[model samples]
Target: MSRRRHENFRELLSKREGFTVSQVSFQNEVLEAHNYYRDLHCAPPLQLDNKLSRSAQIFAEELASKNQFYHSNTKGVGENLYMASGSNVDSLTGKLSSNQQISSSFSYANIAGDAPVTDWYNEIEQYDFDYPGFSGATGHFTQVVWKNSKNLGVGIAYTSEGDSVYVVAQYTPPGNYQDQFPDNVFPEGQC
Candidate 1:
């Protein structure tokens, strides 16, 4: 099939399968979210790196295509991945009424554009500021605000079945190294 025709067919199939394909790039949203959290931690802002973004995008697409969730083996970079399914509910006002019954079917609601970043940043709640250290639970949060991580890259993709979405973000000069956590990840408001 011609590329255009194939694209149209895929779109039609997605709709029929209860998946709304989103081509929206969450780059800006992701960047803003990262900087927002970084600022709170008194870390300098990170600039977006195109090469890293491309690499991240490729990995994200691979995860989506294979319907798998795992970290990439790419060296020399810190990575974070997020996968979520169900309706693309809005963060602020997507709450369902108590009386509302949940449905197994999916809705066409657009995916929460900033969900991945939000979820990653939310890990801060579990982070201990007084004793900074590396922990699987708070790694994502730490990478976002890692003081020495100066470059950022973000990528997002949806599963082939359209039932899930995956987000991948990479950081330069990766963070969370042993014995360096105290210096790289600082207490809130302490640069």
Candidate 2:
């Protein structure tokens, strides 16, 4: 490329929004968080899959660049997505109310690295082990602890403007099968 073109390209790149590729530490944080929750339900730990990670990363980038939220079209892979925006970059914490309701508190700042995974796991409060089945509200939690899901891949991207974050987690041998919930999603403390 010519010098002028090279300078112009650099300028364009600089104007682009900032995106954070999943680093080793961030990946570990997500994995550990999932395992912690999985253990509660007696599910085994999940291994990280590179191929799924790459696919998830690509989708995460797309979502961040476009500032949109949606699931990927990848067939047969279980997926979860989370997006949060604010001025406060600290961790977001929530709790179930006395009536078993989700009460959330928001602050101004960017989202913390592991907050998305925690948020996804918190859906457990809505999951019913006795009537194990798919529900939009608890799908993310079920996917995290699905015994049939042996592999996991996660991707995260921060919006170019640094005001939001998008998280994607993909699973192999996906969970939430209509007839397989009984076998895949077990009661807590039962393997």
Candidate 3:
């Protein structure tokens, strides 16, 4: 993977290929990713009436107003009410409300495209294991966010860690979740 700090989405876009680089004009990746995740998990499509829709617009405004936004790409992209997290989420990624409700949720902002893994299946084919996540991890993913008053925001996930990149979008409401388990023993929740 490239060691140079991405600084901002613009800088990051410049490093990517297959799309015209622009903060405002370049949204295919965002839309595609959102759609892909939405369908895979069968989540609701973007609703104009939802509060998250407005949040997305304000985020775009903030990004456009900036002269040159810069951020680090070393860490994976994520956000939580208390602290952003990865694998250790169930441990320390949320803040329960006075009513004992978890106040934060996660959603993929972008996810469209297919990176054929079979193409990488070559005993004799050399691989670029150093490319971001792993060898044969084709395609790209990204995101840009702006939090509300408490305003906790996170940038796109710049990683080569998927089989494809379609069905992506730019906004996801907090608290939304997917039903990953039907027979799960845990009390019936969004899981």
Candidate 4:
């Protein structure tokens, strides 16, 4: 483990969670025990604390209209292997394919799609303050991903939807948000 690299990682970790000089040094020592920071990819460090939110204009009548989806891909492992030793003959061969395996998953949410979208949206917007669950404790949020070569990412979302006002808490990552080091367990790979 290079002392310089260890020291650098220590510096970054210190900025995380307000670590004291001694704590930073101690963690660095622990990290060095396994050379955990050796394979750390410094470029585009992993994003650890990513929060997402989104909202759309739905008719008040469409109160029951709702949908949500999640997707994921697991790759990097070698191809699957099968063993064969039947009566005909005994042989060993490698099974490989150019394309990465893809598995799809889906989830469906039922929304009250029968309501008048315009009236519902306007009603929610106007009476959001008076709306019991829609105010203070509830609100709307938004999340958008721009399609650019840079893959520029920006998230603007709401957490607590409010009453007749339907006020929302600003979705901002904690100032401590930073790229993960060493493990990079939470890599934000291309979608």
Per-residue lDDT for 68 in model 2? 96
Query: Tens digits of per-residue lDDT for model 2 on 3-107?
Result: 466445434533444323324456667788888878888888998887787677778868977899989999989998988665432244232122432111111
Tell me each candidate's TM-score.
Answer: 0.76, 0.76, 0.23, 0.13
Q: Give the TM-score of candidate 1.
A: 0.76
Model 3 lDDT tens row, 79-152: 22111223222222132222432111111222111111111112113322222222222211111111111111
Ranking by lDDT: 1, 2, 3, 4
Higher-ranked by lDDT: 3 or 4: 3
lDDT of 4 by residue, 14-131 (tens): 2444433332332233223212211221222112111211111111102211111211121211011111222211121112122321111100011111111112222323322222
Q: What would the per-residue lDDT of candidate 1 be over residues 52-164, giving only the tens digit for each residue?
A: 87678778878877888999999999999988755432342144333443222222233454677778888989998888888999999999889899988776666545556
Candidate topping lDDT: 1
Model 1: which residue pairs collide?
none
Q: Between candidates 1 and 3, which one is better according to lDDT?
A: 1
The CA lDDT of each predicted structure is 0.72, 0.71, 0.25, 0.19
Q: Which stretches of candidate 4 lie over 4 Å from their true place?
A: 1-104, 107-123, 127-134, 141-170, 173-191
Error of model 1, residue 7, in angstroms: 5.7
How good is model 2 by TM-score? 0.76
Candidate 1, run of 10 with poorest lDDT: 101-110
Give per-candidate clash totals. 0, 8, 29, 29
